[model samples]
Target: MIRMPAEWETHAATWVAWPHNRMDWPGKFAAIPFVFAEIIRHLGRRERVEILVRDAAMEARARGVLDRAGALSANVRFHALPTDRIWLRDSGCCFVRDGDALGAVQWRFNAWAKYDNFQQDAEVAGFMARAAGARGRRAGMVLEGGSIDVNGRGTLLTTEECLLSKVQERNPGLGREGYEKAFAEHLGIRKVIWLGDGIRGDDTHGHVDDLSRFVGERTVVTVVEPRRDDPNHAPLAENLRRLRAATDQDGRPLEVVELPLPGPLTYRGIRLPASYGNFYIANGLVLVPVFNDPNDRVALDLLASLFPDREIVGIYSGDFIWGFGAMHCMTQQQPALAVGE
Candidate 1:
């Protein structure tokens, strides 16, 4: 049987692609590399960090940032892999463990159905599967890593807006049942919990990572907006309602905890997706995104209670979110090969 492990499980390494596309971040490319380095600093301390670079020149520049941040390069491996964008979570390979060996599901990516320059990003999963020495299976579904979250057990979390909606529709005719069938066959997920929608300003339709995330086996930390005037209030509240009534693969009630959304972060008038739900869970740390909002500490404190065994660290992602993603969007974890692989 194949299973997608939870983020808290031990990882062989965390994968990150170097940000070299200035068009994605616009005028803020200068600071994005440093943010990646700071994230590598925390992740390198816990597990091996594999850095993907387009070329030697890019590797040298990434090394400079890692050096300045005092990140240990011994375990930081660099790959000469070129990518169109830095959102590797959506483009990278999704790992599944079968017994002791790790396998990968190469989910097709259409650049979130919003861009035509996604040809390079579409083939990333095949490359990643080769790098991990794992057998790869094609999912044949237009899916992104940010669109789904799993409990490493049998339950998978996603959103209706991302996989099933007509607006920014992916896999044109693939409704909930079709998508769920594909997930079960490819990732061995027995249950899928679908939420309403994502936060406003999300370019990937509605990625669940920006709205809801599974923090434990049967517990989730979802974002909520209190003000009715805000655009995100109704959608988040509706998702919270769905989560409260949802159950896992075993029919157990889910313990849903509400995470606060950071204040609306805008650049020139465009509101970037700046929610705290995009945090990444590593071996011994949870890397959260903060937009300099007053609720940054509150979000961190709440996560600390849920992840008491691990250190909870916040990374400033105001400039990075201009591309509309954060720490979780930039990284993907490869679970450690279990015993007897």
Candidate 2:
């Protein structure tokens, strides 16, 4: 059994898959790698960054871009492995800690609701875990890294839309109770807090990172769209209300932090799901996705307050969000040390 660790802890490295597929990006594929490279720059400063490439040729191309952008650091390394896409948040290993040792739970990746072709991406977990020198355990159940959040205690935050759906066929025999047991054994999670739905434009079928996130133990930062006419207004409002009413593993009420959603961001006739809730926490920094909107400052200020010790930096995600996700949806973390280490 493998149990995922909390995001606030130390990390040995971060995992990212280089963006290469133009089909996923349509005509804007050229700009996406630069965005990824910028993120790599931020991550590489603090800890090691392991980037997955299709082959040596792709690695050379990515390296060239990184060099041009001045984004490559000594901590950044490349792995020439084939992958379906660049979103590591969906296909990477979920790192956990067992006593003092690190273990990984390799969940079945199906390209989120089995939307895209993910034959190679599904095998990323095992490859990433082995490269990171962690024990990998393959779980028959399907899951995504962005779908679940841990408090470093025993509580997990997720949405029913992603995990409970029968359409994806990830969990055929696991009902809610069965899921609880599976999570308990594999992830060392004692309680599962299920939210009703995710944001509207999310194609991943309600990843919790887009709707709600655990900022701290017994505390969550949720996106809120106050306009009743807006599509996400009701669902996000309901999620906030649920967080306010929910209790943690200690039987205490959760402290809910309300974060405003950026106004609708569109590109090439497509409205992307851009929200401030999808921020990634790293070793010494919190990388947030900025939509080039006025609300970017507000979101940065709020997240900065959340993590005073760590630096809060926001990168323009207008081009990156075109793929329907942002920074948090593109990267995964590996813990540096376990709880007892």
Candidate 3:
């Protein structure tokens, strides 16, 4: 059985793309590589940090940044894998383990149905399969890692606004049932729990990683906004309701934990898609995206209790959010494979 492990599970390595595209980060491009270095520094302590750079020159540039952050460790490696953009979570390969063997699930990537230059990004999974020496299984559907969250067991969490939207139609003619069946066939999921929509200003429509995430097999930390006047107030409330009512594969209600949203963060009057929910779970640490909002400590405290075993570290992502995403959007985990089936 092919199974995608939970983020909290042991990882052989965490893969991320080094930020080089000025267009992706706009005026804040100069500072984004430091954030990547900070992230690598955190992940390298526990596991390998595999970074994809466009070329040798970009690798040199990344090395300078990592060196400055004191993150130039042996576990942090660089790969000359070019890409159209830096959001590797949506464009990178998702590895699944089948007994003792590991393979890559190469889902179709179309720049989230909103960009024109995604050919290079679309080819990343094949490159990843070759690099990791993992077998590749190409799916006939379009899916982004950020659009789905999973528990290693058998259940998944996703949003309707992302998978079934007409505006950003990922896989045309594929409905809820079609997607549910595909999840089972590709990722070994048995239950698909769907939420209504995502928070506003999300470029990828409604990626679940920006709204909710599974902390364990039965517990989830979903983002909620209490201020009724906030744009995310109603949509997040509805998602929470759906989650509380949903059950796992064995028919048990899910444990829904609330993570308060950091008050609205806007850059140049544009509401950046900033969320405490966009946190990455590493082997011994959880890298959370923190804005300058007062809720940064609050979000970290709540997560510390939920993930008692792992150290919770907050990365200042105020500049990184100018790219419309945070640390989680830039990474994909390769679960550790066991020896002998």
Report the number of the highest-lDDT candidate. 3
Compose the digit string of candidate 1's lDDT tens values, residues 17-99. Answer: 98888999888889988888899999999999988898999899889889999985688999888889988899998988965
Model 1 pairs in collision: none
Q: Model-by-model lDDT, in order?
A: 0.90, 0.85, 0.91
Model 2 quality (TM-score): 0.96
**Candidate 2: global Cα-lDDT?**
0.85
After superposing candidate 2, which stretches have Cα over 4 Å from the reference? Answer: 1-3, 167-169, 338-340
The sequence of per-residue lDDT tens digits that candidate 2 reaches over residues 1-341 is: 34567787888988998888888778777899899888898888899999999999999999999999888889989998998888888888888886677788898888876666889998899998899888877878788888888898889998887888765656776778887887888898888889978887787888899888888887789999988998888888878888888888778888899999999877776668898888999989999999879999999999999999999989888878878888888888988874445
Residue ranges of candidate 3 with Cα displaced over 4 Å:
none
Query: For every model in order, what is the number of clashing pairs?
Result: 0, 1, 0
Ranking by lDDT: 3, 1, 2
Q: RMSD of candidate 1 to the true fold?
A: 1.1
What ordering of candidates by TM-score runs from best to worst?
A: 3, 1, 2
* Candidate 1 lDDT score relative to the true structure: 0.90
